[model samples]
Target: MKNAKPDLVYFSGFYSEATPFIKQLRAEMKDVKFLAGDGVKNDEFIKGAGADAEGAYLSLPSPVYTGEAYKTFGDLFEKETGIKRDASPFVAEAYDAATVIIRALEKVAQEKDGKLVIDLKKLNEEIRKTELDGASGKIKFDARGENVGGETPVSLFQVKNGAFEQLKQ
Candidate 1:
């Protein structure tokens, strides 16, 4: 790599393998830029990579919430769970997913012999048609069941001083 030094080195794997590989790369090539996906955007990765994790770029394929709706959800989440909402980057997204499921269930659930019965096919269809402004931002599924209503598909983050900070778009 010294002979053909690239400007950047991108790793597409989990922290378990990426930590060691990136540490080695950082040790050998301090001048090159390092980038990875959400899999390595956690405290574990930073701890594993040590100082080598600094200045590394990470991408999260989910929305970053900062609006009032999110703030309200965060407050309630902290109160109910006794854990800060920001503790996990995916909490808002998970909450939005659960909200979507519950809404779908409400739409498709039926009463049969005093018992709730939900048709799996109808529930799936209702879920696919979901459109809601959730804690993580807009939630809408495309034809392929991929959320396409988010402000952006991927939020860029940089590891600075052993902490992941989301970069503004």
Candidate 2:
């Protein structure tokens, strides 16, 4: 809880959605986790972008995240662009939008007609209490109006006869 004067905190993200809160957290000397990728085959791209590899592959899912049992994503990438990539990260992130909507819906439910009014404090509070399970995994809100998936079960794809299919949970 950033506002409640917690002792320690951490943040992990890749894009601008993470910027505003991290900037505020830094002001209070909070601990924000910076996750950099390593083990990426494209070292040249990382170097060109002024980034260092932290044992992660940028712009794609890691083998562990993707479950590494499917080849469709890899095959599709090759078919489209003559390059292969892991799709776990991108595919799993579909819940990003769903979580956003679910949280908003939860708040709007407070009104009889499910219409929401723009109140920053109420939005933040309602969001913090949400614990909806999403397609990617569990999307629980934290103190800072951010949905967090802390060690939730991620989706896994299975490969059969050189094809990848989404596995039912």
Query: All candidates' lDDT scores?
Result: 0.84, 0.43
Clashing pairs in 2: 37-54, 37-56, 38-54, 38-55, 38-56
TM-score of each: 0.75, 0.33
Residue range 17-101, candidate 2, lDDT tens digits: 3334434545564343333221222323223323221212122233233332234434545587654343224433444455566
Quote the lDDT for 42 in model 1. Answer: 67
Candidate 1 lDDT score at position 86? 66
Which segments of model 1 are wrong by more than 4 Å? 1-4, 61-64, 79-84, 109-117, 142-144, 166-168
| lDDT tens digits by residue: candidate 1, 103-151 | 9999899999999998999998998899988899988898778988766
Q: Largest lDDT belongs to which candidate?
A: 1
What lDDT score is found at residue 101 in candidate 1? 97
How does residue 147 of candidate 1 score in lDDT?
Answer: 87
